[model samples]
Target: MPRAPNEKAETAKQMYLEGQKMVDIAAALDIPEGTIRSWKNRYKWNATLQKDNRNVAKKCGAPVGNKNAAGGPPGNKKAEKFGFFSKYLPPETKEIFDAVQDADPIDLLWHQIQIQYAAIVRAQRIMYVEDQEDSTKVTSMESAGSEAYMVQMAWDKQASFLQAQSRAMKTLQGLFKQYDELLKSDLATEEQKARIDRLRAEIAKVEAENKERAGGEQPGDDGFLEALNGSAVEDWADED
Candidate 1:
């Protein structure tokens, strides 16, 4: 069932539309600043402000006898884009679209890179294998007088982990490549360019160390540990 809207959220939205800062609104309403900010983003207060501004302008159109008061032709579709979106899109999705409309493409790509990298790093812990003897067992079926069990040997788990990690790494690498390409454009700042270089260097160092520990074996080999002990992922997590 859908939850009912909170009255406090509505009050916060009104306060925000009145040009109040999130922190100030939080103080006024006895709510946490983080909560206020979340509501602002979730409900897209900025988009609401834009609509209100347009309505205000329409209400107070140019004074009489002013040539500048001549607006766009009657059939103008200048405002149709927002209208169409509002009519068809769910509130949450429309809010996200409104929020990202002014975001830089480079910044957006970088955010994806961070997210992908984090996922890859987190998988190491979830899919960790202690040794060849380690295995996973689960009940496959249960019946009135019979039962079935499925057991995955350590090697099988390791192989599956390697396959999944390899796919995840490829996705991360693709994001890195896209970010690097975007960084080459003039719109990129020095800090943004430096971030990719630093990340690439850290990841390369980790891979090299892992290779050494594995006796230089290729990925998915029995000797490889998937760089489970590397601090590169830890550093990335700390940064985030």
Candidate 2:
């Protein structure tokens, strides 16, 4: 016996999923676009597409701190690009990067730690802290005045820098822990995704209403940052 009339709907779904546009799928399947659209609406194709995109992004190594890694499985164009671009990466960085080829959440957290540590280095460089060393040698009290001041200044600078670095590391470690927990989270089910979508729609509707009431003005990213700060997101996150 034939499988069922609903099998055609399944076939239509597969064609739509495999990169076929609605019109093209409808034409090829000899079905009206409206009928295909109805099948798509019934089956929630958008969520399916989002999941597929996430899988593709993972396979493509989509900019998750490992874009410059050398080599990959053969015949994949993304792998070929990764192979070509990775050689240009700095040798010192490559040595550390190549030592571990895993993309697990723990590996990602390790990379985040390195990046946060380098941020401290960059902050030091921006402040020209490298030239802060003192070589003044003072022995006699008469000659000690200027040299003592220089030595004390140098000591204070070093002490301040060390304190800043210590505080930054502690803050960054906590943030990375939160991110690692997020990364280790299991994928959301369709029901959860739908609920999230509905909540987002509600928020967007309120935003639109507010924008309209305020002479069509909307807040840019700066405003969002100010709001976040006012909301204490940064304070709660341990940011200074």
Candidate 3:
């Protein structure tokens, strides 16, 4: 009497098997191309997509590699040999590491990190000073005492740069610790560890110089932060 729904689906499947594109099959059966593709995907019929029958090898019993393709060993020896480290760090990560090989990766990364940290400290100080400066301008000072208070506040902010230098020192120390841990573990290679050690020494020297400068000066206005935040913030706030 009536054909089964499964029977209709099977017939559609057979049409797909018999050299029919998804679009052609969908048009013929009044079904969507997505439905046809779904059917093909469910059945794992990969051959229907190929233009030539030569490329359509057996799905279950296929050779590992083609004999025609060149060289002694087909797969990459370097990738296969590197075990867990290679599995986590694929070719793409290795390529990035390779690109920065000439310069010390640890040193470069630490410098970048320190630069970012210094920028942040400088920014915070700038914001604080601008807020104080704006307050001085906005408030009506009837006395020299009020004027002196505003001046002191500005001076305090300039001096706070010395305090911020300590923060920079702490940041470098933390990074050094992290770099040391990373190097000591199996995560990085010997070359990476050596570079990290070299970078650590350079960073330590920089921090020491900054410490000496901060210690030698007065606490608030005349320190390292003032020098950095000087005309830059003035220009930034002026622009805004």
Q: Rate the local accuracy (lDDT) of all candidates.
A: 0.70, 0.54, 0.53
Question: In candidate 2, which residue ranges exceed 4 Å CA deviation?
Answer: 1-83, 110-149, 153-163, 166-170, 187-240
Report the C-alpha lDDT of model 2 over 84-181, residue by residue, as the tens digit.
Answer: 33435554665565566445554465456557646754755543333446334444444635533324455565556555655665656575446545
TM-score of 1: 0.53
The alpha-carbon deviation from the true structure for residue 192 of candidate 1, after best TM-score superposition, in angstroms, is: 1.1
Whole-model lDDT for model 1 versus the true structure? 0.70
218 Cα displacement, candidate 1 (Å): 14
Question: Relative to the unseen true structure, what is the C-alpha lDDT of residue 167 in candidate 2, on a scale of 0 to 100?
Answer: 66
Q: In the order shown, what is each candidate's alpha-carbon RMSD?
A: 12.8, 24.3, 17.0
TM-score between candidate 3 and the true structure: 0.29
lDDT of 3 by residue, 1-240 (tens): 885556546766776665455565564455787987787788666655463354555444446786634543665543232333333455577556556757755657666656755675565556455444533333435685555223346656544644665455445446656766666666577776676556446645554576688675333333333323232333223322
Among the numbered candidates, top lDDT falls to 1
Residues 129-177, candidate 1: write the lDDT tens digits.
Answer: 8888899899999999898999999988987887776666556656766
